[model samples]
Target: MDISDCKLLKVTMDFSKLNEWRTLPCPKCEIQLDIVLACGQSFRWTQLHPGIWCGVFAKKLWLLKQNEDEVMYQVFGGKTTDSTAELIDYLQLDVNLNDLYKKWAKDDSIFSKMVDNKFHGIRVLRQDPVENLFSFICSSNNNIERISSMVEELCVHYGEQIETFGEKTFYAFPTVKALASVGVEAKLRELKFGYRAGYISRTAEYINSQEEGEKWLYNLRMEPYDIAREKLQKLTGVGAKVADCVCLMSLDKPGAIPVDTHVQQIACRDYLPSLKDKKSLTPKCYDEIATHFRNLWGEYAGWAQAVLFAAELQRPKVKNLVCLPQGRKSTKMEEIAKVSEPKTKIKRKKIK
Candidate 1:
């Protein structure tokens, strides 16, 4: 089915009615609502009830619910004049995910197994660039729970309050200027942001200094993926992984793969078996792994990577693994040690 042909019409007679709901036919094969929302690509969404989620985007709060055949959405605080266009772009309904999956699965046996019936309906989101940037800055060396918490706090502290539902209040993601005015670093520290506090503040300040600000980030979409990633890395706390994430999720660079430790483990285990014996993933190995996926999956390589990453995340954690050498400790062990280490002093790196 061509998503361009998909149209969204109001279910009720009065299109301007307050709290009016609209249903858009979203086939399960094309877009899986649950996997798309909860798959770690985004952080602001909250599952308010079973099969229903509430999220804020573009300074508007929306409620989305999905069934086997369709997705129902309603805007609470603000009216969208072009609701259909917004929904289509936001969900990327125009791209046929099933076709991409079939094409990607042809060259890769490992990817074929990964993209089984269980992984269907997973699609990469096209998020706002500024929100994507700051959210990812909070993601360095962080888990999803903490990342979500930090982002929520940032919104609550600096963003405009959009609406209140039950005990939950929704706020828009803060503008760069608004965040910079709050002395973001100190405020974030007070909110328990740890080392990431400074990175968010400095990155925001840098963006604000530019005449285009948010537009500067948005315009990267027109550049080559490598060039865009290079420019993004100039921001504080943005490494290759974060830049690639921004490229893949927000900048329409579907070939950009963000290889963190989890993705590296998958590469070592499934794709590059020779790397299993290596102690750590060097820069070269990382690039090679990313390149291998790009070669295998073509333009939508990052989407395939996301599916594999989500599979790894959902897999049951085994406390005692049988595969590793008896004397060797896993990278996860090293991470635990680093986290448990006592903090004797606070050291801050000077941002150029």
Candidate 2:
């Protein structure tokens, strides 16, 4: 899979009923493809154009574009199945995000203040458990760009080829057996996976050795959140954060909150000031912070955390200004902050 071979299609396709593209009536506020796809929840999506995204998920290559009212999509590969149903499930369209936002805002004042229209559509993607597990494994000590590249390499090396759109060929996410094959660790190391190569390879081997195999991983969705997180931690390279990510993103546990260093800062600065000086997140500290958030935001604490986390990520970098002595002027930091601010300024609607 040569990166140079993939080219973005310049021309937009017509959305006629006669064509393969079909529309799902979802407002931009409800399902903003730009925010949700680009957010750290999933890494498979690539922006083909400004508003158009092409990704491989659910064993199919998807071409999607959104407008103010609806999302138009077409499937290029995989069996002829009910793509509409698949899209609805993948996007978790049944989850009523407006109501959830309102609920979170009502409960947490900080969340209410942070609720900007620009980050409204940030929701978790219901990804495959196996893909979600492995992806997050690659996420440890890695940025989104690097994790995405690693995932692409994984798909290209082991996953089944689906189809080629434009100059790029698509491949489904690899199965546990495919990842478990001998020499996967060495090959991944050769691909510059670093220490995570062993984690992925060993985890895949462990999963493949199970009697139920991939089904065992998906079945954790039925278990309690605590149990599921515990079970996931048993696998190689899966810590509390990674396990919680799998639970929240794929295993139907909305209460699971992943607390990393960035999340620690968010918690200490805004919500938990008493623990602001804490340097490292111990198991006890992690549980305490997660519990506090769960109490503040209720059942869907994970979702609320995601919204705030994205807000923090998009927040202007002005810490130098904050740290400046009283009445002192820092022109350089101010200019950087102004430039980093989001261009879109749609006022947030009051949640009553």
Q: Identify the leading candidate in terms of TM-score.
A: 2
Whole-model lDDT per candidate: 0.73, 0.78
* lDDT for 226 (candidate 2): 87
User: For candidate 1, lDDT tens digit of each residue in 1-352?
Assistant: 0001111111111212225346666678877766677666778775544454668886787777766766667777755566656767788777778778777777787888866787787888999988898899988766666677778888999898987764457788888888767577887888899989989988888888898876788899999998999999999999888899899999999899998888989999898998888787687888999999998888888988888886776622212112323454445322222112122221222211
Q: List, residue by residue over 1-352, the lDDT tens digit for candidate 2.
A: 0111122223222223113456777777777787677777887876654555778888998877777877778678899997877888888777778888888888878898987898787777889999999999998887766787889899999999997664457789999999999999999999999999999999999988999998999999999998999999999999999999999999999889999877888889998898987778989889989999999988878988988887877832211101233453444322222112122212223332
Evaluated at residue 284, the lDDT of candidate 1 is 88
Task: Give candidate 2's error at residue 2 in angstroms.
Answer: 24
C-alpha lDDT of residue 31 in model 2? 76
Least well predicted 10-residue stretch by lDDT in candidate 1: 1-10
User: TM-scores of the models, in the given order?
Assistant: 0.82, 0.84
Candidate 1 lDDT score relative to the true structure? 0.73
